[model samples]
Target: MDIILTSLINLIVFVLGAAIGSFLNVVIYRIPAGLSLLYPPSRCPHCLTRLSPFENFPVFGWLWLRGRCKHCQAPISIRYPLVEAATGLLFLVVLWNTANPVEMIGYWALLSWLVALAFIDLDTLTLPNSLTQSGLVVGLGFQIARGWDNGLNPATVSHALMGGIIGAVLGLWLLDIIAFVGSIALGQTAMGAGDSKLAALMGAWLGWKYLLLAGFIACFLGAFVGGGAIALGWLQRRQPMPFGPFLALAAGLTALWGETILNAYFNLFFPTW
Candidate 1:
């Protein structure tokens, strides 16, 4: 009985995520283009033809449309369906890992923000301030509110939350400066403000303790990929690569499994502490 109920809940969450993913497509396109997210409904980029209701179905719509604009037959980017599916999977994962309603919502918001930043950075090499800055302020606010809602002591919760905010901001700022100095020292732009914002959001949401884990994982993956690309001739030496995706991946993993990983590490190495 419990299994069935859980499966049903996960399915519902996936569907909701798919729906939100559809909207995120609009955000990914319009936000970077400086277009209004509202007004002027989704239309074909090539023909400017407004899509019909049936043709607008999330992932299935792209499949049914045969990856082409219905009016002009211009090929649709495969990324549309990919984004929808990815968001659905993220929602499923978050739901599976989180039991608290408040935490679930917060995790979803973080996931959505990361998805936008990842794609935007991939395409344009930029992460807009709107999502990152808003995420920092809003996410920390929720942490405090969650503490209050749980009937925690005001003074303790306030101090803890304030410390988390300060620690996270400082950690990310330090990372930004290190990356900046490294770029200057190497005579190549190795990282940018977008990556810094990504780290900031991760630190804010996951707290200072988990920030190190996220940063380490991101750096490891980034380095491995950078080396591979350099070896394969896919990238030139000193060429820039988007780091937001690695950081985002690390953030999602940390959000879901930070405690487990941290506990395992401590049990193995720092048992006495």
Candidate 2:
């Protein structure tokens, strides 16, 4: 019975996450387009027909409508349903990992913000300073609050804060150097401001050690995936590709497995910390 109840709760959380994902889709699409996310409501991009409540039911609606606008039968972007499903899966993972309601909420909030950042960067190739800056502020405040609640020493708190700042600055500066060198070598911009902002945000959340780990993981994943695509003849040589999604993925993985990874590395190398 307890197991069944837990499963049921997770199912509900998934559903709720999908609902929030639907709204996030609006934000992702509209914000970059310089349109109000809430003013005119969701409409068919082709025909501009307003979507009714039933017509906006996340993945189900897209499936039922056959991936077309209800009024004009125009094809809709597949991103909508994909985002909703992805968000639902992310929420399910968070729910599985956390039993504390407050902690769950914090994780959910972080996940939502990350999702928004990921899509926005994918579309615009620029992370809005607004979102990244706000995330840094909020994440630090939350960390401080957690530290205080746990009765951590002020020295520890100070160390974490300094580490976060140093990590963020280092990540951003390293990316800047890479972009400069890549531009000189390739004659085009290799990384965008968005990528730098994202690295900074990750540093703010995970501190210097995890930031380094995330960067290494992102680079490895991007190289593997990009190489696979090239070998498959899907991406041409010298063709530009978005790197934000891969970075976001790396950050997400780090969030879940950073402690384990750090512990393993320390055990193997230093063993005394």
Candidate 3:
């Protein structure tokens, strides 16, 4: 009975996540284009036909429509459904990783932002300040609330504020330094300001130590993927790729398993300790 109940709950959570992801798609498409997210509602870009309620039902809706607009028969991008499904799976993973309700809600919000930022960067090579700044505020606020709930000690409040602020500032500083150096070497912009803001937001949530780990992971993955693409003739050696996706991926991993990964690294190299 417990197993069955747990399965049912998981299913419900995944559906909830998918519904949220459907909204994220609107944000991803509209925000970069300077459109109001809530005004016009979801519509077919090709035909400007407003999507019907049944036709806007997240993953299943796309599948049911055969990935095309009913009114104009224009093919819809598969990315919409893909984003929805990925968000659903991501939520389930977060559910498995933590039992704390507060943590789960926080992580859910973080991942949602990450997903939207990643796709937006991929499309436009820019991360919106609105999302990044809002994320930072939310993260720090969450830390303060959680700390206060634990106790009313001054030390506790100071630690929470310091952790969030220092982590965010450190992330921004390090990225800016890297960008400056890389720009000098390349004679072009190496990283966008948006990337730094994204990192700062990440740091606010993960703290300074985990933020460092996330940065390392982002760099490593970015290098590997970028190199592979260049080698395969998909990109030129000098081509600029958006770094936001890699950063988002790294942040998500760190948020979920930074401690486990760090411990494993130390354990492997310093087993005697």
What lDDT is obtained when candidate 2 is compared to the true structure? 0.81
Q: Where does candidate 1 have its weakest 10-residue lDDT segment?
A: 159-168
* Candidate 1 Cα errors over 4 Å, as ranges: 1-4, 271-273
lDDT winner between candidates 1 and 3: 3
lDDT per residue as tens, model 2, 1-273: 999998898888888899989998987887777888779988898898999988899789999999988799899988999999999999999887776665567667667878988888778776777778887776666556555555668976777678778777877876777678978998888888778877887787777788889888888898898899999999986887777787788888787778888789889999888
lDDT of 3 at 148: 74
Sum up the clashes in candidate 1: 0
**lDDT digits (tens) for residues 151-182 of candidate 1:** 76998678657755965696678678869897
lDDT of 3 by residue, 1-273 (tens): 999999999999999899989999999999999999898988999989999999999899999999999999999999999999999999999999988887889899999999999999999999999999999999898778667756888789779878989999999999999999999998999999999999999999888999999999999999999999999999998888999999999999999999999999999999988
lDDT value for candidate 1? Answer: 0.84
lDDT of 3 at 137: 95
Candidate 2 stretches with Cα past 4 Å from truth are 99-103, 152-160, 185-187, 264-273
lDDT of 3 at 106: 87
Per-model TM-score, in order, reads 0.93, 0.86, 0.96
Clashing pairs in 1: none
